[model samples]
Target: MYETKTIKEKIKLFFIIFFPILITQVSLNLMTFFDTVMSGQAGAIDLAGVAIGSSLWVPVFTGINGILLAITPIISQLLGARSYDSLAKKVQQAIYLSMILAIIIIILGGLFINPILNMMNLESEVRFISKYYLISLGLGIIPLFIFNTLRCFMDALGQTRVSMIIILIALPINIILNYLFIFGKFGFPELGGIGAGIATSLTYWLTSILAILIIHKMKPFKEYQVFSAWVKPKTKHWKEQLKIGIPIGFAIFFETSIFAAITLLMSEYNTNTIAAHQAAMSFSSLLYMIPLSVGMALTITVGYEVGAKRLNDAKAYGYIGISGGIFIALLNGMILFLFNDYVASLYNSDPDVIALTVQFISFAIVYQLADAFGAPIQGALRGYKDVNMTLIIALVSYWGIGLPTGWLLANFTSLEPFGYWVGIIVGLSTGAGALLVRLRYVQKKYDKQQNPSVD
Candidate 1:
């Protein structure tokens, strides 16, 4: 149903899909940004508490969300193949899987939250805030998972604007909720950082409800009968989704957890250090949405072409997405380089925090460059279902190489906190190189398969 024969057309198609996803991603991250800024206003302790809780929560959320993301490529491929009958069933199974994972996470958090925080030797107030923040946040995990599953389905169908609109509607509500709860306005208790978690959870429920309504009431989506004809969960369908999803989950887990781990490790330093680290990390994450959006767009586009058996078109989309990510990264780098000090001041006004945040952001400029290179290629590989190798690469690069290098430097060298940034840069560069090679190999293999006589 969808075809792009020329590079120009492909680029146009890519951006059409890309821009909405970009808005969705940016809007989503802005929720987190507001949470940090609002909580920081409550006090530095509140900011650090939210940071620690997020460090524990984000990796887990992203990893599981990554698993659900498998639905995008799967559904996109099915769409490209024009096998419309099975889409509803696939989405139903993904929802079931998401529910199961959400319960598991909630249970695990209940069991581990106290022990993990206690083990950290954190300040009393910080630990108290972290514990409750996670607990409050856990309430929304199910709805959040469900929302993400639906989002992946919509994205695969090239209805990305739907997601963008939903998030935009929710973003303001989340900020308002954060304000009322954090500052104890309108008779709301002054919950500080914990309020952010509650706001986020409430927002997740709203988004999930909206997604369900849209799918049921909308024309093209309702045609899929995602709700009208409910399908029973089948172990076979779950396995099929998990097989592709597990590797993706671990790959993303490994990557995101490295940042989480760095946050936890920084907890050993003074509160100022922790807050500064989080501010820089948070802004860097905002910048990262650009490349991440491109990568996700590639997953849909490349997956569609691959499903249609248009391997050359898939390859072209991959190249375009990767190049576009790099170019955008260059622009981001310039802006960050020029405005690092100003950006740092936006997060907090403590002169020490601002100075340290500037240093951390300098390192982020390099970090973004590597991410721009690697993330899109990884997305392309997902299109090909080349995920197991990516899992291996992520594990080796982030945990095996990046963490160790950072740990050694942080403890044994003068780089201290900055050492972790160096390690991240190195690790990302390595992963990017490995992923690029993997993409080329897959491209050639598909090429050879299509034309057996090729040398």
Candidate 2:
């Protein structure tokens, strides 16, 4: 029987886990903003290319990211039970198994970059620029895979701060690279869009190498098979990971693809509108990191408790995380809404772009709120390893509601750009509601077993 933690303790645990992840997320997401701004400074055509290129390949990366990220929760759960053998196999298997998948994505994304851009019907300049960015982006896929694996390892072992430090250390270097390459300073070529990709790629590789070094040298964590030379992939065990990971991949893909699909759909509105929309989306995603990190911590704590057969603790932690998320989201949404104009200025300078961005901020605000409500609920589910059904919920909410509403509002209705945002709000709310209901039912049922009445 596990004792439940007080709300204050849960909040403290959440933040200790959150600040590090928040730092990591702020660095990671800033890359997106910086990537666009550097390219935008080069030309609108450069920015357009990035948009198109991102639309084409982001879903692919989402699938890969989700699968690889599965390692974290698995390791978290296993650690709860002190199962070092299972943890070692899972870590080793994930590292070796993911390399093959990453290579496939690299090759496929590399090969089809041009064709995909053309298919999107972007301008010739945009297509060319997109191809350049895609090549560098594709080249960086393996490095990202390696980096994420290490981050997951560290995060699972309860030191999410290590990943944050690596990201922060690499950030200054990334910024310098972009400045030099994008503008052709210091006798370097004006690589433009390619420069943004190259800078990001270099950062990925650098951070990954540093994570490798940390894992090898760190106390407590270095004893695992992941660090041992003899820890090779046992092919038979790949299925075990795939079972947990594949659904996660599709779960992530389902949500991310909806965004990508909407972006492509939104392009038909107007370039300025699309540009403003993208800017707001980027800012919103960055703001989203706070609640997202909260959700991640919830997933970790819930998994740990559940693994230890402390179901009451797991359920209590889930509510605490979710409540904290709501509070954080409301505060964040208000600030972002209040500072919409100033926030938009951080990314681009054009007045026309800034004007469109204001409306986009409203949508972004709603997403932050809805994400707070939904994300932790989903996080708890992930902690429970109930992935397949969540994918179904996402599919229905996103495709069934989100896609159609966006299309109607953006194209057919008088809402124009606001309609597009409204569509997102509706989608997020629907998904958030469904997820909450499911979480309640699941938690309640599980708690009965974990906390049965004495006869």
Clashes per model (N, Cα, C within 3 A): 0, 0
Top candidate by TM-score: 1
Ten contiguous residues minimizing lDDT sum, candidate 2: 1-10
* Per-residue alpha-carbon lDDT of candidate 2 for residues 327-439, written as tens digits (9 for 90 to 100): 98999888987899998776567898888888789778877798888888877888887778888888888788987888798778888767867877788899999998889
lDDT per residue (tens digit) for residues 14-72 in model 1: 99999999999999899888888888888889999998988888889889988999999
What clash pairs does model 2 have? none
Taken over the whole model, the C-alpha lDDT of each candidate is 0.92, 0.79
TM-score of each: 0.99, 0.95
